[model samples]
Target: MKTEEHKMKKERWEKDMMLEHRRIEMEEQRLQWEQEQEIMFCDVTTMDDDQRAYVLAKRAKIAKAMSASVGETASGESGV
Candidate 1:
C-alpha cells in the first residue's frame, strides 16, 4: 500500500540523517585532536632538549591515562 511504503521511506530517511550526523561529529573530533597534536609538536620544537623530553614524557603519561580510561592499551589495542 502507498501509506505503508511512505512510512518505510520516512524511517529510512531518518536513519540516514542520524548516521550522517554521527559521521560529522566524528570528523569534528578527529580534526580537533589533530589540531591539539600539532600545537604540542610546535611547543616541543621551541623547547631545549631537557624541556622537550619533559614535555614529551608528560604527554605520554596523559595519553596512557586517557587510553586506560577508554579500555585501550598505550599501544592502542583493546584491553580485552
Candidate 2:
C-alpha cells in the first residue's frame, strides 16, 4: 500500500538524521580532545626557560594531587 511505503520512508529518514547528528557530535568531541592534548603537550622549545620551569612545576603539582586522590579512593573503598 502507498501509506505503508510512506511510513517506512519517513522512519528511514528520521533514523538517518539521527545518525548524521551523532557523527557530527562525535567529530566535535574528537576535535576538542585533540586541542586539549596540544595544550598539555605544547612545544617547550618556543618557551623561555622560566616558562618551561613553570609549566613543569604546574604539571608535577597536578600529578601529585591526582595520585593522592586515587590513594584516598582506594583506601575509602577498602574500609580503611
Candidate 3:
C-alpha cells in the first residue's frame, strides 16, 4: 500500500539522518584527538635522535596511563 511505503520511506530517512549525525560527531572527535595530541608533546629543537625518541616515548607512556584510568576517576568526579 502507498501508506506503508510512505512510512517505510520516512523510517529510512530518519535512519539515514541519524547515521549522518553520528558521522559528523565522529569527525569532530577525531579533530579533537589530533589537537590534544599536538598539545601533549612539546617540541624539542636540536635534540639528538636518541634523546628525542626517549622524550617522545615517555610522553606517550604518560598519555597511555591517563587513558587507561578513564572509567574510574572521570565518572566518579562527574557524579559527585
Candidate 4:
C-alpha cells in the first residue's frame, strides 16, 4: 500500500537522522576529551620534578583507594 510505503520511508528517515546525531555527538565528545588531555599534559610538562612526583603519588593513592572501594562493593553485592 502507498501508506505503508510512506510509513517505511519515514521510519528510515528517522533512523538515519538519529544515526547522524549520534555520530556528531561522539565526534564532539572525542574532541573535548582530546582537548582535556592536551591541557593536562601541558600542566604536567610545566611542573617541576618535585611537583610532578607529588602529583603522580597522589594519583596512585587515589587509584588504589578506588580499587579497594570497588572490590568491597562487588563482594557485598555478591553476598546479597
Regions of candidate 3 where Cα sits further than 4 Å from its true position = 44-69, 72-80
The residue pairs that clash in candidate 3, if any, are none
State candidate 1's TM-score: 0.54
TM-score (all chains, Cα) for each model: 0.54, 0.55, 0.56, 0.54
Candidate 4 residue 26 C-alpha distance from true site, Å: 0.3
Q: Which runs in model 1 stand beyond 4 Å of their true positions? A: 44-80
CA lDDT of each prediction against the hidden true structure: 0.78, 0.78, 0.76, 0.75
Error of 3 at 7 (Å): 0.3
How many Å off is the CA of 59 in candidate 2?
9.7
lDDT (tens digit, per residue) of candidate 3 on 1-80: 99999999999999999999999999997996776576466685767898788777777875776676675577665311
The 10-residue segment of model 4 with minimum total lDDT is 35-44
Candidate whose TM-score is highest: 3
Per-candidate alpha-carbon RMSD to the true structure: 5.5, 7.6, 7.5, 7.4
lDDT of 4 by residue, 1-80 (tens): 99999999999999999999999999997996675455445466678999888767766665676578688888885311
Tens digit per residue, CA lDDT, model 1, 1-80: 99999999999999999999999999997997786576456667768999888778867875776668586555678743
Give per-residue lDDT, candidate 1, residue 2: 100
Q: Against the hidden true structure, what lDDT does model 2 obtain?
A: 0.78
lDDT of 4 at 77: 50
